[model samples]
Target: MYVTQASWKSEIFQVTVGFLPDRAQIGALGLVVLAVLASWVVKLRRRLAYRRAVRPGQPVHAARYGQGRGADHLGAYAPQPGPDDTRA
Candidate 1:
């Protein structure tokens, strides 16, 4: 009789007595949801900050690829003549 009463008082029994998800499990799930929402908020804030930081007239990739006329000297729009091509 005393052993049965002790078993009833165990941590597993107490936690699983009635509800599907106990308070601790619920709190854990809540923490996971909160973390996801916090990550989303952080990502959104970072994107907004990046958007605001770009210069008004410059293309977004210009800084990474090299900006303005100097950058275009070797690209598609540059002169087609190669230095090694000899036409006598």
Candidate 2:
């Protein structure tokens, strides 16, 4: 009788831990999502901190191109006001 009971208990344990445990899968997926979300949050925080360290009223041209003559050509794409401007 003791041997029969031990066999039953082993079978039960095996089934409980078998393939496709809903709770275990959910827990594992939740951990993966949490890790990805944490990494994204840290990356965004670093970007915002860098943006803040830049002084306000600093022209984008000065910061990026260092007052080069490229700023002269930067406005070449500016659209001229057309006769249809007042209609909008």
Candidate 3:
């Protein structure tokens, strides 16, 4: 098979290449779908594994804090005041 390169001085050749249908477009879409499915399966497996790692009646945070639920067990989402904040 002979391979030909487009020329910079030719306007007709540029138009031909510009209008050419991309054959790999379907393959690229398939690859993207496969990747998304793989990621979803991985995330689901992780969640199932985590559920298996815990027993009934066990607090979800017990492993991290080594303690059961309490009023003081504020999670990481607890708000913090910024240095420039003027609120009391």
Candidate 4:
């Protein structure tokens, strides 16, 4: 089957124009975006509330503070023993 360039161009234009969103579709998309934004705001508020609830003087768990081996309670890196160091 042989198709001309003009026919292809017309088909492309028709597809593009036909797929253009209507008012209802645009409104629905706007609502979805607003809902997502509202949910994110709610989550942020909840996180802020949690932070406010926590006391500054409260001691945190040692496991929560450390990363790898020999890390201090404050998540700071501590020096590991070398082969030359005789101290056990």
- Give the number of the best model, judged by lDDT: 4
Task: Please report, as a residue range, the 10-residue window in candidate 4 with the lowest summed lDDT.
Answer: 65-74
lDDT of 2 by residue, 21-84 (tens): 7898577667768998999999999999999778598656443544534334568674554797
Query: What is candidate 3's lDDT per residue for 1-88, written digit by digit as tens?
Result: 9998667655664454556466655565567689989999999999999998885886574346555344235667645557895643
Poorest 10 consecutive residues by lDDT, candidate 1:
62-71
Candidate 1 per-residue lDDT, tens place, 22-72, comes to 777777667768998999999999999999887487656545544535535
TM-score of each: 0.40, 0.39, 0.39, 0.40
Q: Per-residue lDDT tens digits of candidate 4, residues 1-88?
A: 9975668866775566557678755776577689989999999999999997795887776754435344333344656668996644
| Candidate 1: C-alpha lDDT | 0.67
Query: Which candidate model has the greater TM-score, 3 or 4?
Result: 4
The C-alpha stretches of model 1 lying farther than 4 A from their native spots are: 1-21, 55-88
Q: What is the C-alpha lDDT of each candidate?
A: 0.67, 0.68, 0.66, 0.69
The deviation in Å at residue 30 for candidate 2 is: 0.4
Ranking by lDDT: 4, 2, 1, 3
* Pairs with backbone N, CA or C atoms under 3 Å apart (clashes), candidate 4: none
Candidate with the larger TM-score of 1 and 2: 1
**Models, CA RMSD each:** 13.5, 13.0, 14.7, 13.4
